[model samples]
Target: MKIALLGAESTGKSQLALALSAHLRNSGLAVHHVGEYLREWCDTHQRTPTQDEQHHIVQTQIARVMATPADTVVIADTTPLMTAVYSQLLFNDHSHDDLALVHQALFDVTLLTGLDLAWVSDGLQRDGPHVREPVDQKVRHMLSQANLPYQVVYGSGPQRLENALFCMGRQAPQWAKQLARQESPTRWSGLCETCGNGDCEHRLFTGLLVP
Candidate 1:
């Protein structure tokens, strides 16, 4: 299953993704967590990206993750629609057209993760035209208008992660159960002995049958 966790800036999507991966791993499920695309793009370009650049960065990441092997359950930290919202709200550039293809590329599940969380004003600060609450509300409205199946995960820290994971686990597909049995038993440890690294930890197969 492909799951996208999306929200406005500083809404804890990254932390939630990491925590979910950790929790699932601890439960014995193998999961692959795809970090934020915007961060990758910024590192590659050696500078902060413009609004349009951000949109394309997210699109590229989505495409790459979607192309991953079928046995993997990808948890993308952000989605293209999020880039569109950020650009339109912060840069006054209505780049919704750029996201048309991306909108179509989304999988069966897109979990919107910032409905009840307070917005934080750090990292990539915005001013002038940016309005946090209204913009978030607008994003929620857009998702609803698109008829996307999404659940708002509220609360703070671990509570939010718990809520998000609970919602996602409930939506877990039946096919995932079969895939779990097929996965290598060692993959559930969230470790890579070859490179002696824990960064690419696997967490998907940890709890396929458990609630």
Candidate 2:
């Protein structure tokens, strides 16, 4: 399974990617985690990339994922789609959108980290808490425009990991399922209605029930 994690800065994509990879590995699955190449690039260069550098960043990000061994479950912290979104957000460049979307469509599961997590500053990488909503909106808009299916993962700490696992049709731990069942149905109702996807609804409720 190729799982692509997408979201605005500080939404915990890196953490979730690591958690998912570890969890799957514990379950005896071969996992290959692809970290965000842009972060590495920025760190090495000591600054954010320019508008002209976005294409190379996008290419390197997707190329890493594509190079992963096929026998392993690929967990991509961020994909080229994010680079495209950032390009549009920062530079107003839309040239990379088509290429990014084409590659993103190949992922088996695209999980959008919810804005529920508090935004944290990350040196040159993170813009600010103010940009989170706009970036989130842009990501959703792009995915919708591309007719891509995605699950919005919401929660804190371990709960967030459980939510992600549920979205992927995998069984979460027993205690997590119990906690989910204890949650007010009203909470999930609003989300379900908002999503309007039968599969998402099924997955949401399924994680609440004992098998």
Clash number by candidate, in order: 10, 0
- Candidate 2 versus the native: TM-score? 0.82
lDDT agreement with native, every candidate: 0.60, 0.81
Candidate 2 clash figure, as a count? 0
How displaced is residue 207 in candidate 2, in Å? 23
| TM-score on alpha carbons, each prediction | 0.68, 0.82
Off by over 4 Å in 2: 170-211
Candidate 1: regions farther than 4 A off: 43-47, 51-55, 96-105, 115-118, 125-130, 173-211
Residues 38-156 of candidate 1 have per-residue lDDT tens digits of 77766677666876566566568767777667766677787667667766666877666356335534565566654344556554433322465566666676666766666655556
For candidate 1, the 10 contiguous residues with the lowest summed lDDT are 187-196
Top model number, TM-score: 2
Clashing pairs in 2: none
